[model samples]
Target: MGSCKDEDRNEINCLFVHGPIIIGAGPSGLAVAACLQENGVPSLILERSDCIASLWQQKTYDRLKLHLPKQFCQLPFLNFPKNFPKYPTKHQFVSYMESYAKHFSIEPKFKQSVLGAEFDNLTGFWMVKTQDFQYFSRWLIVATGENAEPVIPEIHGIEKFQGPVMHTSVYKSGSEFQKQRVLVVGCGNSGMEVSLDLCRYNASPHMVVRNSVHILPREMFGVSTFSVAMALLKWLPLGLVDKFLLMVANFTLGNTDRLGLRRPKTGPIELKNATGKSPVLDVGALSQIKAGKIKVVEGVKEITKNGAKFMDGQEREFDSIILATGYKSNVPSWLKGENGLYAVGFTRRGLLGTSSDAVKIARDVADQWSMINKIFPDIDTKLLK
Candidate 1:
């Protein structure tokens, strides 16, 4: 519990005699912690926020549901309550995670944000430092996730606009945008869902079409598409699968104007070959598009005092704007490492067994953690079960 002095901090590499430190309290972190505890591996978790799954509580818009089914989404030893709905709501997810924490009795030291982590060449342990606390551990699990920071696109005069600007990460409900002409930027699930939520509140929500995205219904033929996609991806090549997905996306929600905005590009948004490997399925958004509840615009060229200027050279006015853009994974500074540091759940989906993220990372962690416990029998990995 002692703060590391600037000089003593220099000896952090030698001070890391602890077993391991898990960062974040989300599904991945909790899962790893449970597994480690089951095995009796001494570990500690450092979380910046007071509650578990803080990101979940902070980022989602109204009526947001998990894209995956409850059955597939539950973590480690825990199962979603039998009474829970098929696609668990955000609140349901938070509750489930809370239960997981209680069941495991994993107490994450709150308000202790990991600022950076570094691996010492002389010692095998990782020196993790935070704003208030510092610890040393042999292993590091960077489970902070990919969507940790809200992504706001830069536009000319975006800050100069008089209207309020907010990102989807902090969007809880649409009641604030009621009766206001709002622009929902980005065409992903967040963008579409936020736009629809605003519409239900009697707000005129305009969608800014950035690119064409694939949207799938939560249930198809009485089964979740998430299950179906998981099954298919297991056997098919990723490239072929991506191509097939593009076709299906085009068929269900045409290439351009799916959200009233035009997309000249027939393919999915251009993500770096490293970044755009895995494809995320979109649901409800597609139905809303066909319902004519949302209006789409090409792109934003600049922001004006009156409103936004589009790439098509048209200016429109809005009382407020919501950026349903995306988020970036923010690793705590304490865990900064040179090598032998592991980052799970931030992978760009590509060829099978290629990288770690999502369900794949969960499975890998389960396997690797088990293997390590077996090799280091004294580490007390039985808590994982």
Candidate 2:
């Protein structure tokens, strides 16, 4: 296998090929590569960006941090630094990904935007084509996480609004909106965190929570809520776990009825298990909402030149709009093939890279390939005439 350095960020050079081809160069890709190497299976990573973990380095908000504790989010063969906080910041996590790649001797081909992949009947291999070159591999893994594409809702009159509308990808800090009236759309984890960040900067921010959602504290009475969850999930049914969690939340945070916050009729675990929409694990947003630092509003009915019209017949003005709406994933678009393709980042099951999923994936793929390589080796990757 050959190595593609990061200096060629702008140029798409055909420098390397052979072995497994992993896409995205994010945590999932790096983790799979690392584990495959451990199993004596060489792989090459093709990343569209110059650097690894483009989503973390470029897309995430400035003040953003991991919602889960650091211990649960570790990749295979590497652990977070001991000094990292309970919930590591985006910067810290990005640094960890870089170190993981380096430590595993994983050098990904940079600036290789995979146009599409197709199984070449002549070559008997999956040919991954970037802008500059095509590389063949027996296995193709799509590790681009869920946020690969931002899902911007079609707001009525959104085009007519005369404010700086931006997605959470480019949103860095709230200091830029100091004293400005801002409307934050959506109520996911990012939305809640961004609203609180604006409050810290004294921005008059209003959040639009369209539906009921689960809100959890990072800790309950000094015990990590995640730790509690792992303990409960082992013994109870998902519905029972949800009830127990709702009880704990009510006990700790009190009913949020007065704050215009409504708990979903369904429990968080049930919602996650059923719909794949993750629960918002609260860090410090609720206290601020209760203190009148951030105002909560109903969903947007429409948009005006200056502000959004709410479903409750209320219209308010704001200087800017920050969309914290989440992301979408269509793995087949990037890693198309006749067969033998795997997706590792964001699945319907949330983030596979955040847990032991990648370890299991690498192990399974290696086991499967050991048999393949023994018999008709290069049967899939045979060079086309």
Using TM-score as the measure, which candidate wins?
2
Alpha-carbon deviation at 7 in model 1, angstroms:
3.2
Candidate 1 residue 336 C-alpha distance from true site, Å? 3.5
lDDT of 1 by residue, 1-385 (tens): 3334554545332234244577777776777677666555555777888878888877676588876677767776678899998879989989988998999898888887777687767645577777755676667777677766787789788887899999888788889878999988887767877887887888888888766544544554566655665666799865655565556556655654434544333333233344452234555555666676677787898888868999988999999888878877766534455553556555543212122242343444456556766798555322221
lDDT of 2 by residue, 179-200 (tens): 9999999888999999999998
The lDDT leader among the candidates is 2
- Candidate 2, lDDT over the whole model: 0.81
Each prediction's total of clashing residue pairs, residues at least 3 apart in sequence or on different chains, is: 30, 1
Angstrom error at residue 94, model 1: 0.3
Candidate 1's TM-score reads: 0.81
Model 1 clashing-pair count = 30
